[model samples]
Target: MKKIFGLLLVVLAVFAIASCVSEPAPKKDSPLDATVAYPPKILEHKGTAWGANPPAWLMEALKGYKFVERMADYQGKIVVIVEQDGESREGAELAASRLDAIPRISTLMGLRVKDTFAGAQVGDKDKIETYMERVVKVASETRFSGFMMEDSWWTYLQTYTPEGKADKRTYRVIQLWTMSKAALEKQLDSILKGEAANEPKTPEKERAIQAVQNAFYEGF
Candidate 1:
């Protein structure tokens, strides 16, 4: 009887294996008349003007979602100059003076004057130069030609109140400026698509700005 039971178990196992082997796989979709839809192409444009505060032409050119810069140029094509917010003003000022003294500084660093984001107490001269070189290399690969300090240098100075809270204000002005500009640029982008009235026209010099804007925004 034990021998018969063992034989029966062996027979069931064979049947199970055979059943699994006989099962069919799912069919794959063939190339017959089936249509596949793809995502739409996004428009690319420079973000020089603040998005929310975008010049009329800029907003129009960028009909789709567009990336723009705040601390740098609006479209990442222009460079911006910045200084610390009041905490690291000293370092920023020092760097600016250094740059002015050495016009070739940008070339040495592989950066355009517009691309350098110098800050205070961020690093020593050698370190700053090295950092700028790397920054320029990377920016060149992207949409930017160069960048400059957009930080309000005056703000950095004002933070040092008469009460001697200078130490508390220890921050890299240029780095902070870069970050702040990026944030503001994003904020402005949100408002780019919405309708807003044109910026007020002003003096002759201001009128010249319109022509530049026309070129930038119109591109024709």
Candidate 2:
């Protein structure tokens, strides 16, 4: 009877071990696991996006105004956004000449104009959209990193024109700003370095803009 009792005790101990082995261990929190959603690296980009627009006529008329034959070292990587709205040739010429006269406008501000342009016609319906798309395309095709559409001229014309269509023309022009993206990395680098930090941050975007304010100021 003693031997049989000892054997039964041994059998119970084995069964107990087996039951513990079948159950899974609880999962513990890992320190590294919590930060899986964080981005691998931060991208610091320059914020201010300078813009310029020529009349529609010159934008369409001028051959290479839309293209960047040689990329200038203006405002670091702050992309220069230029719009050649070539609707009116004569007006476009006047605008371009005036814009060119403003020293450092192209280099520091990153905005330039080749000329003034005529507003899109009412009967054409899709003229403004088509023209703006072309402007965006030209900028990209020429490897320009950013874009800006100035409908200031268009607004003036619409004031005298009939309702509905006046606002219609300007809406597409406004939409261009959202559609464009420019790199300001180079410009940001210049401003963040030294004296450029002293400038006021009026436009929130300009807060991050770092570069020579104009061509005259030399940044060390």
- Most lDDT-accurate candidate: 1
lDDT of each: 0.29, 0.26
Under the 3 Å rule for N, CA and C atoms, how many clashes does model 2 have? Answer: 22
- Superposing all C-alpha atoms, what RMSD in Å does each candidate have to the true structure? 28.5, 30.8
TM-score of 2: 0.17
Candidate 2 residue-wise lDDT, 136-195, digit = tens: 233222322243332222211111122112221110010012112134333323333432
For model 1, give the 10-residue run with minimal summed lDDT: 39-48
> Model 2: which ten-residue window has the lowest total lDDT?
39-48
How far out, in Å, is residue 9 in model 1?
72
Q: What is the TM-score of each candidate against the true structure?
A: 0.19, 0.17
Which of the numbered candidates is closest to the native, going by highest TM-score? 1
Model 2: lDDT of residue 204 = 35
